[model samples]
Target: MATTTRERLISLLSDTNEYKSGQKLSEVLGCSRTAVWKHIEELRKEGYIVEAVQKKGYRITTRPNNLIPGEIKHQLDTKKLGHEIHYEESVASTQEIAHQHALKGAPEGSIVIADEQTSGRGRLGRAWHSPKRSGVWMSVILRPNIPPQKAPQLTLLAAVSVVQGIEEVTGVDAQIKWPNDILIDGKKVVGILTELQAEADRVNSVIIGIGINVNTPIEAFPDDIATIATSLKIASGKEVERAYLVRAILEKMEKLYHLYLDHGFAPIKLLWEGSAASLGKRVRVRTITGELYGNAQGITEEGVLLVEDDEGTIHRVYSADIDIPRES
Candidate 1:
């Protein structure tokens, strides 16, 4: 595919640390120097810091903070994951679109990302507050060759991937909570919801919904969740670039997914356990049938939680809302 003029301009400027003259850019792109100038302005409008000097041409001083597909796809390292992207301005949910694509046999690792999700969904159909231009509201479609019963393990794997990505990008030590929540300083920072399309014995596709509070302000949260929810910017005292975070997550996820497919879930399970915040702590889990108050021992091979109650009975929790241990 031929690259667009704007894309070519971005590429030329991004490929080198030194500036290229306007005449040289015009000759290479087969366009007028005025066109190059226009594209440079467009790049600036997209949040890229472009430096233009008298002797030197245009050079990109800093990358854009936005999650534009072109900005994210520029230097992404993944092979198949994120190869095909469905970008939207606003939507009800990326999971809904990913499901539609998966039903049409979309390739594994296909992703649907949106700037804002009006009706973002969490575990148990809870409303995930996803305001415009504040968070990462995206869903990934996976067509793995595994039984549907083992699908819960993917949620755990995704939590590890997210924590790794956040730590790598922002230098924040994020931890995982039970099944699929990422926390920092004992506050929620990320949430993962996994939905599957499967039959009795086989699996069609798995749509993993990931919502990360990247640059959301503390005041943006509602009164109900203000105390329990936080964002990377709020914790680190600096705004996190969403584009870099997205690429890092895709790269980490592809690596982990390949590891899971080759060596089973043992490696991912170890990583997940290492980053768990609720392990070996007194916790309360609210399930559909009833509530269980016990010590969170560990997770099973199928990614189920093993909670030991006060009566010395072990309960296997497949799905529930876990209350983290309170500070002393």
Candidate 2:
């Protein structure tokens, strides 16, 4: 499998021994020396630090040092997610550019990422504070064979993936706040905005915009959000490598998306519940219609939030701003 080959190549390159010859790698990988050479060339095109010499063979020197297109391409070890990544130093919003690209028939695994966004956003058209070099503001163009009604489920799936990815990469226990927020130490570190393109009931593509606070300094946030906003650097007490985190996120999303396609939302819903912070807690949900004060029960099978108010009425909330109520 392509994934297996990629993994094996990474494992081999990670070996601390001196550069292993292509002939040796061919024998070890159980493939032809030409096959090993081809893999090395591919790695080079993707931005790896592969060192090829007449006698020394190929030895990966070091992973790229940035999250730019070249670096992300070089460090990626997955078969999907970012098989083709389009990165920009600045943009209005990746979602906007991704939608345009998807409309023009971009590949399913293509990812549109930006180091900074002039106008990033979240659900309900709220602004997402994404400053330059402080976070990941990116979107993916996915052409899934799913119905439009079930599009909301992808948001939850992404929430789960973001939490898992952040935890795996930064070693911080990030929690989910309902639909699409990854909170670490009770503060939001990640947010997702999922947009879909469909032909009535049929689907065209799903562009999922993700905003992750990576190396944000403590005092970087605005005064209002300073207490509530945080970064992986702050949560982990160390500055994490951005490219590795980006790759981890893409890998996690690709794996979860495959499962979602195989079996509706059941599996992802369970995982979301396990790490969710709002479920089973006293909460107040404010929606456009009105407010629903209740205890947060599990979400509906369709990804709608289920809340039981004080009157025992179960409210199926499609969209709401949820807050964990503080006791007097």
The runs of at least 3 residues in candidate 2 whose Cα sits more than 4 Å from the true structure, single-residue gaps closed, are: 1-65, 326-328
What C-alpha RMSD separates each model from the true structure? Answer: 2.2, 5.2
Candidates' C-alpha lDDT: 0.89, 0.84
Stretches of candidate 1 above 4 Å error?
1-8, 22-38, 53-55
User: For candidate 1, lDDT tens digit of each residue in 169-201?
Assistant: 999999999887899999999999999999988
| Candidate 1 colliding pairs, count | 0
The number of the candidate with the highest TM-score is: 1
Write one digit per residue (lDDT tens) for candidate 2, span 1-328.
Answer: 1235654775577544577888889888899988888877877776677877788766778664356654555456667678777888899999999998998998898989988999999888889888987788889888899999899899999888888888888778988998788888778899998898998888899999999999999898989999888999998999888878888888888899999999889999999999998988988898888877889999988999899989999989888888875456
Query: Weakest 10 consecutive residues, lDDT, candidate 2?
Result: 1-10
Candidate 2 backbone clash number: 0
